[model samples]
Target: MAEQQTWPHHELGRKLNNWGRWGDDDQIGTLNFVTPATRVEAAGLVRTGKSFDLGMPFDKDGPFKAGGFRTNPQHIMTLLPSDTAHTKDGLISADDMIITGLQAATQWDGLAHAGYGGRFYNNVPAAAVNNFLGATRNSFHHAVERLISRGVLLDIARLKGVDRLEDSYEITEADLLAAEERQGVRVRSGDIVLLRTGSYQWFLEGDREHFLGNAPGPCLDTCEWLYEREVAALAIDNHSGEVWPSPIEGVTIPFHQVVIRDMGLTLGEMFNLEELAADCEADGVWEFLFCAPGLKVTGSAGSPITPIALK
Candidate 1:
């Protein structure tokens, strides 16, 4: 995306990490800043009561392309036969089920989603997460309650005057500040920052290859920015939260190491923010109420979510 800037930039990210910043046995990491008062403060931003949906549709034609390590969701239905279950006695009933990966569509990555050097977030051992009980440590269960707060959108692609950023275009700290200035907004503590790279619009235009694979996004430097800003969570309209083919050689998804693992930040990916961005620009408001809660699937590493932004 940019120069060969390695992740875990010692000057920035390494110092901003929340490793034990909360406690030695912390489950919800940086989310500790999202108190009840924070939600109350966020609710005040809804002047017009307009809402934006941040979730992509869930189905086979999902974000992940063919032959990836993770595939899209699969739907299955089962028919039941019983004296009290059928419509033959003037009763109509049906049941359906979905068997799919948790993070297949618009989803939230849990504390157990990614790690490095045999350690997950808050020094939770990676082995504790991959066990037979299905991610016993730092699972998505801990995130079931802390997904509501203030939401801010920084439309990087719109700032660059492009429908889509070049694949692997690394977003910089200056770009973030410039976006804030242009939008006339200031990111507050416990804000769920939505970094709109316009990948959602590309996915809408049938550019699946670029949206699913070679999408542009932030680099590790942006993780440092997230940390310094005290953001409660991060959502991006791209595949991975960071740029692909990692900025560092021989280190795949290094941004995951710093953002999710080291900093213990909650990450939301594949959110549909095209309408939200347009509405924000038209209404001259970039801050709103962010709300998205996990399914509370015990031991799961991630879960599908439908985030809503109220303006």
Candidate 2:
């Protein structure tokens, strides 16, 4: 029989690393597991042609403040006249410009986005990861390369028989397992896992403060749980992938440091998962073909993405 796989769990300051697992100059982190064969296998999950888009509509009226750390997308028409002639009276065209942050809406957090103890993924300096332009050492280009895979949805709200979990609720390992059993699906290696707290449902209903200020999500406890499973990436409909006012007292989002820093895990946030969950509910299966990758914007900390799930 094949030897059982064991994941080494590390304490804070001491990381469970995949640094040299791929290579010394490896920009892509855990995504190295997503081989070409994985894509072939994942494509088989698409039995029906139905597709679900997991991106929130982005504009000035979206979920972010105007001039905050993260802002809504700003679109401007370059041509003052709608039918500006480019060459002659017969030729006309329209042009526009977008000044927007990559992480403003549904997006993927690049490898250089976060770290702990001043070290980024693979024990590199955080400062070196991003420069005056954008990310350099670990950019969105590397993050987007390994996105096609099997998608798994774990609806925590539906599992708990509620519209949404409590604002401060922390999803535990048991909750994930319960959702898997309830949905008759198991998370596999190279799978992009998405969790739904029904928080997006409230945002869709015009509850912005409750959705942004506080939300239900995972905590530091699941860092090893997901790392051991060898998942390609994780996504959620909430603002932060972890619970707001995190359970770790006197600290803010230690879970982020654990997963993104120590485990080299990429994360996606603000995904619109309401329709996807409803479809999964109707069909008793939570697995599908996930084809969502960050844009190939070189040296970007993150990239806005509209992920699609085909079933």
Candidate 3:
């Protein structure tokens, strides 16, 4: 096997100049300004099993929390109330009631989403940013069109002899390797590593108490290894990539800062990974992966996504 390549400026510049735009972060979120354009290839969406629902429900007329940056909306009306009424009246609602706010569920944080000190994605300094467009000082130049890439699922559940891994268990580098070794799989660079901790199962069951707690997630060492492996992005079945109330001393989910700032890696949290994992196990081929985040417009984050994989 050959050594994996890193996407740092020097190497990335050479690759871009020679091979055109590749890599996950290259997808700029701004495609099809007025009209809808094809964001993903139809062939890439190969559904093998049941579809996963990655959206979180919002409370209707729920009180807004103090100091909350997002203003949650309530869906009180729908286009069609019932098929009988619609057929009799010849009236069909075109829109469904929905509440839009800061999407905390299955979403991708743009490079501009967060940063420590003064660096954004690609390690670009704050001083280099152009704030005239309302973009932050440490913003990442993304438009969403460049996010198309191959995805890989790491099935940690089957390795544990269960339908899903236990919730609140911190996934360690050892755990990751053990799973890989057991499955005879090797993680490649620039692959979107989707980890199935089985937290999503609990989530779908409406177990809010356990879902919000410290769910199974990857440790900092795993983040470091993924960075070293040049993983373009990472998605997990848990809420955040790092387990909540982090065990790392004197730090608050330092892995997030380290991976985002230092490695310029993108994080995908709150994903529905059960079906993806099971499909891979059934096919005996766990490598072909694909993802296309919802086109972000007039919002900080997007709604849930139904990213799929091929055999």
Overall lDDT per candidate, in order of appearance? 0.83, 0.81, 0.56
TM-score of each: 0.92, 0.92, 0.68
Query: Model 3 shows how many backbone clashes?
Result: 12
Mind giving the per-residue lDDT tens digits that candidate 3 earns over 152-253? 677777777887656556777888888888777777654667788888777678675566566777766576467455666777777667666676555566
* Candidates 1 and 3 compared by TM-score, better number: 1
lDDT tens digits, residue span 1-311, model 1: 78855444433445767888988989777788799999999999889989998998888888677777778888765644453464666775556688788998899888898887688888898779655798887888887788889999999988999877888899888899999999999887788899998878777887777677766888866776788788888999987877876877767877777788888888888899999999998988999998999688989988898889999
How high is the lDDT of residue 244 in model 3?
67
In angstroms, give how far residue 169 of model 1 lies from its true place: 0.6
lDDT of 1: 0.83
The alpha-carbon lDDT assigned to residue 114 of candidate 2 equals: 80
Write the residue-wise lDDT of candidate 2 on 10-46 in tens digits: 3642545677667778877778778888889889988
Clash counts per candidate, in order, are: 0, 0, 12
Q: Of 2 and 3, which scores higher on lDDT?
A: 2
* Structural RMSD, model 1: 3.8
Task: Using lDDT, give the best candidate's number.
Answer: 1
The weakest ten consecutive residues by lDDT in model 1 span 4-13
